[model samples]
Target chain A: MLFKCLPPGAEIPGRFPGPVHARGKWFTIDIHCHVRSDKAAAMVEGNAAVSHWFLETAANEQSRRINRENGARTRLQGSSPEKRIEDMDRMGIEIQAISPAPRQTYYGADPDLGREASRAINDFIAEICGRYPDRFVGLGTVPFQAPELAVAELERLHKSLGFRGIEIMTHVAGEDLSAERFRKIFARCEELGLVVFMHPDGFTEAASPITILPM
Target chain B: MLFKCLPPGAPIPGRFPGPVHARGKWLTVDIHCHVLTPQAAEMVAGNAAATRHPREVYANERTREVNRQQAERNRIQSTSVEKRLEDMDRMGIDIQAISPSPNQTYYSADPELGIATARIVNDNLAEIVGRHPDRFTALGTVPFQAPDLAIAELDRLHKSLGFRGIEIATNVAGEDLSAERFRKIFARVEELGMLIFMHPTGFPEARRFADHYLVNVIGNPLDSTVAVHHLIFGGVLHAHPNLKLVIAHGGGYLPAYSGRIDHAASARPDCCEQIHRMPTEYLKQLYFDTIVFTHHQLEYLVDQYGADHVLMGTDYPADMGEVDPIGFVEGAAGLDDAERRAILGRNAARLLNIEIPAAAG
Candidate 1:
C-alpha cells in the first residue's frame, strides 16, 4: 500500500534497444511518466488556478462516486512506488524517467507557492530516484507563469535535485510557449543542454457536427 | 494515360524478394487515400453542408471560417489526372485506393438525393479506375444516412461496379458508426469481405481549435479517436471480427495512445460491458493508413501494431496530406527492408486482392 521507492525494474517492449545504454543485454526507459507527491499537492491545495483538469461529468456519477473527478485524476496518479515496481516487473520496463504530473506543474499558482510546490515535487522525485538509482531517473517540474522564479527553480532541479530534464506546460495558462515572457527560461535550459519536456493539459471534447443533409 | 486493368507488371517501390514467385517487385498501395470527383462536387453544389460540417455547432466563428477557407482550397486543385500521376510517382505511390471526399459523403441527405449522388460519384470513380486500372483502385461511397439504401449501394459497388470496398465518415450525423441502426449494414459489409475506409471530415465541435489549424491538426484525429473508442466500447468489432475497416489519417490517434482506452475498458465495466475483451485487442483486428507525418510516429505504429496492420496512404491533394509517403516510411529508423516493403505496398496489395509482379531475386 505504501512505497518508499520505485518497485524494481521493467523490461523493454519488443526487441528495440532503449534510449539509455545498459550493462547487460537490453533495457527500456519510460520517458513519458509522472510522479505524484502529497507534499507537492499540499503546496497548491488552495490554488484553484493550479488544479487538475476538471472532470467532464460529475465525479459522483462514476460507477461509484469514490473519485472527486477533480481528485488525483486516476489511481495511477497516486499509485505507490512499490506497486509501480510490481507493474514494472510485469511490463518488463527496465527504468522510468519520471516527471511531475501535469496537475502539479502549478504554473498558475501564486509565484511563491508555485515555487514551493515545484521544489516539493522535484525533491520527491529525486528521493524516489535516489532510493532506486538504477530503476528511476528524474525530470523536475518548473512553474512557468513567472519565468524568473521558474529559471531559479530550473537551476535548483538541475544542480541540486540531480535531474537531467525539466517538464513544463505547453502553454502557461492561455499564453503561448513562445511568448517573450518565457523565452529567457527556455534559453537558459538550452544553454545548459537540459531536456525540456513540454506537456499538454489535454484538449476539450467537442460536439461532433451533426449534418442532416440539406433539405 | 489510357484506362483500366492493373498492368499486372506495373512497378512501384522497394525491390524485395517480393512475390518474386510472380514476375513483379512490390506493388505500393496507398490505402488511406482519397479522390475529388467533379461530378460528386457538382451533385452537392449550393449545398453548404458540402463545404461546412452541417451541424449547427461550434462555439465560435473561427472554426467555420477556417473550414470555409479549406473548402475553397479543395476546389482549386484542378483535379488533373497528370497532376495526380506526377504526385503519385514522386511520392513513390504505385496505386492509390480512391474514395469519396468527406464533403461529398452527403450522409445526411434525403434518401433520394443520397442514392442519386452516390451513384454519380461512384460512377466517376469507376470511370477513373477503368482508365488507369494499373494506377488506381476504387473504394465506393454509400448513403449511410439510410442503412437499407446504403446496403443497396454497397451491393452495386461490389457486384456491378466491382469496387474493393466502401468509404464511410467516422459518424453519420452525430450517430457513432456503432449505433444499432448501422449494425445490419456493417454485418453485411462483413459478409461481403469488403474494406470499410473510415475517414474524418473534421471534429464536429471544434470551437477550441479555432485559431491554429488545430481543428484538423488535432480535431480530425481526435474525432476518429472518439469514433473508434465508441466502436470498441459499443461492441461492433466484437460482433464483426471479419470486418475490414482501414481507419485513415494513420488510424487517427487511437493506434498510438490506446493505453488509456484499454485501461478505461478495464476501469469501467458499465461502459465497456458490451465487449468481452480489451479494447486494444479489437484494435489489432482493424487496419491503419500511413499518413501520420513523422518517422518516429510511424515507426512506433509499425512497432506497436506491426507492419501487417499498416498500409501507405497519402490523403492525396489535401494540403495536410502526406507528401512523400514512401520516403517517410524509408526514413523510419527501425523498419527492415521487408517492413518498408510491407508498409509501402505489399500489405495493400494483399488487402485489395491485387497481385504484385515479383522483384528480380
Candidate 2:
C-alpha cells in the first residue's frame, strides 16, 4: 500500500536548532504522539465522557498540578490526518508513532466489543500511518483486559497489519502491567520484540507525584 | 536514644499488606518524602517567585489550559510535618527521605547564595531528621548551579549531616544531567557511590513541554525520559558506568516507552550518536520507584525491569502519594513475598547503599 507524501528515503524538510548556517538538515521522528481524530473521537464519543473524566483527573490532581506547574497547552484533541501531516511538516517531524488516547484503552470494555473496538482503533491508526509511511508509523492498541484477544490482535497487528509495536497503558484500570493476566501479552511482546509503548491513563489517581500540587 | 513518639521498631505500626493493627510497632521506611517547614518555605519564597508565575488566562491561555489540564486537589503548601507524620503513621510508613523544594534548587538564584541556601536547607532538613531520626532520613539538596560547591555540600551532607544521597532535578536548571558542567557532580556521586534520586523540575523552555501542561503531564515524564534518554543516548551511562541513578515517578515513563526510544535511536543517527547499545540496556542500570500507582502497572514495571530495580516511594506532603504504599505494592498482582520485600524496602536500601540492620529483619 502506497502511503501519501514521500516514500522511504525521500528527502523531507527538517527542523534543526541554531542559525541556518550552523544547523544542518536532519531526519525527524516523533516517537510519542496520539490518535485524536474527529472520526476517532466520534467513534468513541459515546464512552468519551467516562474516559475523559478518568483521564482528566488522574492521580487525584497530580496530572492537573503537573500540567499547571509545567505550563503546557491543553491536551490534544483529535486532529485530521491532513492537519497532523501539515503540523509534522511544519515541525519537520518525518515520522510519528501514533496510537489511540490512553483513555480509549479498552481494558474494562466488554471482551468481544473491546476486541472489535481495538481492531477499529488500530485499523484507523494503520490507515493514517499507511497514508504517510515516510511520515508516520502505527503503534497498535491491544485489548489488554482480554489477554487472549489482546494476543490475537497483537499478532494481527504485527503480522497481518504490519505495525512497529503496540501501545499499552501504565496499568489496566488501576491494575499494573505486571499482573498475571498480562503474562501472555508481555511474553509475546518480548518474544516478538514489539515495542510496548506504556502511556499513562490516570489509573492511580490517588498516587501521582506530579498531581499532588494545586492548580 | 529513642526519639519521641517514635514507636519501637518502625514509626508505622503493622505487618506487610495489613492494616495499622499495632500502633507504632512495624518498621516502615518512606524512601521518598518531603519535609516542608515554614522556615524552608520562607527561604524558598524569595527566590522561588522568579520561577512561579501567576496563572494567566486571556493573553496566555496556554498557561490556563495547562493548569486546567493538570490541576490536582492535594496542596503541598497546605501540608504540615506533624500532619505528614500522622499520615505516615496511619499509612504504616516509618522513615522518610526528605528533600527541599524547587526553590531550594536555587536554579534561578545566584550560584554562591544557591550554595549557602542549599546548606541552610540541608541544615534545616538535618535538624528535622535528627529530631526524628527513626522517622526521617534526608536526601540532601545540592546547588547544581555551582558544581564544586554542590560537591562540597554533598560531602558535608554525607559526612557531617549523614544524608544518604543527593536529590537532583532531571535537569540542572536548563542543562541536561549528562552535560559537561554537571559531570563533576555525577562523577562525585558515582565515586562516592551515593544514590542520586533524580526528580524533574520542568523541561527547558526550548522544549517548553511544561508550557502547555504538555510540560508536566507530558513534559515531566518526557523530561525524565529525556534525562535518562541523555544518559543512555549521550554516553553518560557509558562514561559513568557505575552511576547509580534512582529515577522518581516509575522512571518517568521511560521503562514503558523505552522501545520507542530504542527504535528511534537505532533508526536515526541524529537520535543517538554512534551508540551500539539499546536504550533499554542503559535503563536497566538505573533504578525506579513504585510511584506508578496501579497493580498491572507495577506488575509490568517489575516484569519489564525486574523486581530488584523497583523500590518503594511516596512523594509525601504532595498529593500524588499512595496513602498506603506497602499495601499498594503488596496488592499488586504476581509479586511473591521475596519480590515484595525487595520492592518495599530492600531495593531502596541496596541502591542508597544504606545498611539494612540485621536487627530489623
Give the number of the best model, judged by TM-score: 1
lDDT of 2 by residue, A27-89 (tens): 666777887534434555567333544544533343355445422322332446776765666
Candidate 2 local lDDT, B1-361, one digit each (tens): 3234676666432211224422343334666666543554556564553344212211146666534443332233223556656666666776677776543466556677677678887888888777887667778888887888888988898789988887887766555666667777888888888888887765444222324345455555656876887677667786687877888888887788677776655434444552456667778888888878788889898999889888788776453455568878768768987888788777777766556765553
lDDT of each: 0.73, 0.67
lDDT of 1 by residue, B1-361 (tens): 2223437677422211112112134457878656677876677777765445632244247656755665565543425566666666655567788887776788767788889999998998898888898888889999888999999999999999889888889878667787788888999999998888898877775655555566667778887888898788778898999988888888888888888776565444344556777788999898888887788888888888889988888776666777666667777888888898888888878788776765511
Docking class of 1: incorrect
Candidate closest to the true structure, highest DockQ: 1
DockQ of each: 0.10, 0.03
For every candidate, how close is chain A to the native chain A in TM-score?
A: 0.74, 0.72
lDDT of 2 at A130: 79
Model 1 residue B105 lDDT score? 86
* Retained true contacts (fraction), each candidate: 0.08, 0.00
Candidate 2 overall lDDT versus native: 0.67
TM-score of chain B of 1: 0.86
